[model samples]
Structure formats: structure tokens, C-alpha cells
Target: MQDVISKLVKVQELEMRATKVSASDAEVIKALRKGIPDPILAHYDRLRIRGKKGVAIIRNQVCTSCHMGVAIGTIVTLKQGKDIQLCGSCGRYLHLPPEPASETAVAMLPAKPKRKKRAAVRVPDAS
Candidate 1:
């Protein structure tokens, strides 16, 4: 994960350079590098996954990880954290985590259920 972030930082730096090459970009890169001094390269790196040329393993709604149609539930689950839960639909590893709670999210929560009292059942009077 750290490796991926580090690589992303590097790529962002390169992009920034291609655009204008400013000290701000350098600072951003430096900060990210400092935070992640050592990067552990993931065995399933992008290069290994797509190969040198890079292939569009997934597009549209298909999940490259699972090679299946990602369920709506799976998509919602991935919105939470840095690492998302593997899809129930497929076993392939998922990258996105559940998304952080937002204002709308808080609002979306179901309202608390009101406690209901059970009325005592009267047995019919025996003659």
C-alpha cells in the first residue's frame, strides 16, 4: 500500500513537471516521500498485473480484480476505507475502501426505531 502511494506520488510529481515544474509540486513530492521513507513494493504491482504494455483488464462496470460485474452492494462497501472488502460476487482483490461518513451520509442513516409496548392479552373468561 505504501509502495502504491509512493509510486502515485512519483507519478504526480512527473505530471506536475510535465505541466510546469514548480517548487510547490516538489514540496508535495518531498513531503509524501518523507512520510513514506521506505516503500514495500506490492507483489501484484501494476506492471505485473497489466504487464509492460499495460492492458485494460477492466472497463465500465467490470471489476478487474474479480473479473465479474461488481455488485451495487460491493460498490457501496468500497466507499469506506483505504482498502475495500473483496467482492462477494468475485474473489479478486478490491482496492477501494468504504467512503468516510459525510453530512449526507449521516442524514441517510435510518431513524431510530420507536419502542413499542406489547398489550397484555386477556384470556376469555371461562364460564
Candidate 2:
């Protein structure tokens, strides 16, 4: 499953590159497409045709494309690499980015302070 997702991501990147220049990556993109299933490729093509990304990266348990929180079950399935996951909001395929090497390294970093919310002032009504 992860392999399929990786291929999809690569295909997307290659296609994006192809758009910026000549069809130099045509062969590579074709080969990558062969590895992906037809139904999956068809769905990806539908999204791409609409100028939307076919695959979305999952960061902090959220779909980057849709900015919507991903369901826990979806995340679990993605982590297990047992099946493909899709963002419920945007319908794009989801891939979990690789985690940082060490949690301690991240924990040792300083945390950013949260901004305080400003209270709204009531406006006086004009007589």
C-alpha cells in the first residue's frame, strides 16, 4: 500500500514537472502509472484534470490539501500501511509523512507561545 502511495506521489511530482517544461519526463511518468492500479489511476486522473492534487500529505493528523482533521481510524490504517486512506473532506488520497528521528530531539526544542485572544469591545449605538 505504501509502495502504491509512493508511486502515486512520484507520478504527481513528475507530472507537475512535465507541465513546467517539455515532456522530458513522459517515459518515467508512464512507467510509474503502470505500477498503480487502473481504478486508482483513474481517480487520480479525475482530480488532476480538475487542477487538484491527486495525493495529499497527512501532517499532524490533518490532511494538508483539505486542512481537515483526519479520522483516527484512517490514520491507523495509514500507519499500518495495510490499505490506502483518503481525506474525507477533499477526497484526495492520503499519505503520512515520515516522522522525525527522535521524539527527544523534538521535545528538547523550545515551544512557541500561544497568542492571547483579544476581547471584543461593544460598540455604542447611534441615536
Best by TM-score: 2
TM-score attained by model 2: 0.76
lDDT of 1 at 88: 39
What is the C-alpha local distance difference test score of candidate 2? 0.79
For model 1, residues 1-127, the per-residue Cα lDDT tens digits are: 4244434436443443455657776776556545542422232233335432111122333566435555444444444334333333433334442234442443344443322332235878889
* Candidate-wise lDDT, in order: 0.41, 0.79
Which is the leading candidate under lDDT? 2
Cα lDDT, model 2, residue 58: 87
**Looking at candidate 2, what is the lDDT of residue 40?**
94
TM-score between model 1 and native: 0.29
| Per-model TM-score versus the true fold | 0.29, 0.76
Mind giving the per-residue lDDT tens digits that candidate 2 earns over 25-100?
Answer: 7777888899999999999999999999999998876789978767766776776789997777788999887788
Lowest summed lDDT across 10 adjacent residues in model 1 is found at: 52-61
- On the 0 to 100 scale, the lDDT of residue 49 in model 1 is 50
Q: What lDDT score is found at residue 99 in candidate 1?
A: 38
Considering summed lDDT, which 10 consecutive residues are worst modelled in model 2? 111-120
